[model samples]
Target: DAQAAICMVRGHAAEWNISADKIGFLGFSAGGGVAIASTMSATQMERPNFLCTNFGPSLMPVTVPADAPPLLIMTSADHPNVAAGLVALFMEWKKAGANAEMHIYGDGTGPYELMPETGETTTESWSRQMLQWLKSKRFI
Candidate 1:
């Protein structure tokens, strides 16, 4: 899903007058997993999956830029899958020389949804922190 969205976004970049190199992706939880995977797994402007071939280009380009803007990952410390996945993804990003960041909350009131009613926890506030982080990184 992440790869597909990126392919679609990049395929339409020219329509929006945005550079394919300037487009970036971000997500949380499973979405986060997918975003991280998409960044590491795909080549510059190339869709990571053959499914993206549904869209056309002048020609299939090689060496699509792998380096993306920094990532902001958020998860609960107790959520091993989320924690480990994001951590592993972060390591991969650094190894690939792509910038990345992560925030893990120590089980501070479990399952605080990013919904208005739930009231953002210090953990949930990572969303805000992520925004600041992205701004600090000049990603926004």
Candidate 2:
């Protein structure tokens, strides 16, 4: 489904005024697992230009592809299993020489909001950090 969505978006890029080369995948929670799976399994034509997973860890074993898309992983340090899984994933990506970045916020668990509910916390800047990662990768 994720690959199909990429295909669909690319197919309609001109009509949507979207840049086909800048297409990316971003998922939160369980959806993040899906995004990773899609990238791992994708053909070159089906792969997203980049991937961002927020508070989501792969539910299955990970084997980083040599051509894996640039990855951005964000989760809370206190989120135990999730934090550990993402760290492992990051390591795998690095091992494969894939481009990857991660942020584990100390002050919270679960997903962080794009904007803070109370005073600002490091976690609240997740979206901004992701954008920076994307820009650094020249995907934006």
Q: How does candidate 1 score on lDDT?
A: 0.52
Error of 1 at 130 (Å): 1.9
The residue-by-residue lDDT of candidate 1 on 1-140, one tens digit each, is: 66677778889989988766555665544454445446556655654321111001111112223355455555566656556655665565567676556566665334454434556755447657766875676545
Give the per-residue lDDT digits (tens) of candidate 2, residues 63-112.
Answer: 99888888999888767888888989999999999989998877544454
How well does each candidate superpose onto the true structure, as a TM-score?
Answer: 0.61, 0.88
Q: Give me the displacement of residue 86 in model 1, in angstroms.
A: 2.7
* CA lDDT, every model vs. true structure: 0.52, 0.83
lDDT of 2 at 73: 91
Task: Give the residue spans of candidate 1 off by over 4 A.
Answer: 17-20, 47-69, 111-119, 122-124
Query: Among these predicted structures, which one has the highest lDDT?
Result: 2
The Cα error of candidate 1 at residue 92, in Å, is 3.6
Collision pairs in model 2: none
> Where's the lowest-lDDT run of ten residues in candidate 2?
107-116
Tell me the alpha-carbon RMSD of every candidate: 9.2, 2.7
